[model samples]
Target: MSDKDSESISDAELDRQAEVWEKIAHRPEFEKLLTAKARFIVPACVFFLVYYFALVVLVGWFPELSKKRIGPANLAYWFAFSQFFMAWIVAWIYVRAAGRFDRLSDELLGEHAQPSETPEK
Candidate 1:
């Protein structure tokens, strides 16, 4: 595309858009969205990290307990394998939670969006 065509919005239009977004950013709905996301994300992250590291700690500190076999694999192996399932479960939960977050975001943006004035080519 030529530069003229590529440059869609004028600087003034861009400035107006920035101001609209600035206003949106200060709204209570924006704060609610951020807080909701952080609430879910922080706990999920901490839980996963603790679960992941517990295996290492168990193997190092209680080798006998971790080495006790159940079929062909030991406790450590089972624990490690379970982490895969844990990760998948976490991902599933996050996906469900993210749908709610996205809806809230969409509503927030819809409420704040200004009518576009398309610059003619």
Candidate 2:
């Protein structure tokens, strides 16, 4: 449908459409996907935050520990650099997890996903 056709849809029709979608959203398959996503995301975020702040707290509290040498660069410098690697590792892990999430989502929406003659962009 064109943008104008969509815009012309009345409030009552929109409300009815939303209600239908809301019912679908509450189905068991959708809930399972949501739970799976949350199970990975919540703990992963918490781990990242805690590790980041722990490094900050350690650096602030014990300057001597941070200043200790590891070859040329100090311990703190190594630790600081590792934070970037940590973020990248977490992102990589999430990317891997997203494959599972996408599969679950596809399974949940498979019945509702309308078949098209042409491939979607």
Candidate 3:
């Protein structure tokens, strides 16, 4: 095939892909997937921010309380350190949630995927 033929083929493929994506975007399943991701992400973000800021606020506003030693380190230090673990825990939760998201995406694509004509060797 010539370069022009190849270019036209690629352009046609892109156009078809766009059309398919447009259809998928309008699908209820796609909306549900978006909603589910938002539902988890929005609250997770809120919780993380609140927890992170609460530590800062406590340290700033109530230095005496924050200075109270737990083991060798103070409450502020412990809280700051715990943010790392909190981040890891949130990431773990998101990974678990993302499995469901992947499943939903797979199901959506499975429905939408065009059957290839003559399997490539």
lDDT of each: 0.86, 0.82, 0.85
* 3-114: candidate 3 lDDT, tens digit per residue: 4444555667767756766876878988889999999999999999999999989989998999999999999999999999999999999999999999999998787655
Off by over 4 Å in 1: 1-22, 115-121
Per-prediction RMSD in angstroms? 4.7, 4.5, 5.6
Q: TM-scores, in order shown?
A: 0.74, 0.74, 0.73
Across residues 16-49, which tens digit of lDDT does each residue of candidate 1 receive?
7567667767789888999999999999999999
Residue 103 CA displacement from its true place in model 2, Å:
0.8
After superposition, the stretches of candidate 3 with alpha carbons farther than 4 Å from their true spots are 1-22, 115-121
Number of clashing pairs per prediction, in order? 0, 0, 0
Q: Which 10-residue window in model 3 sums to the lowest lDDT? A: 112-121
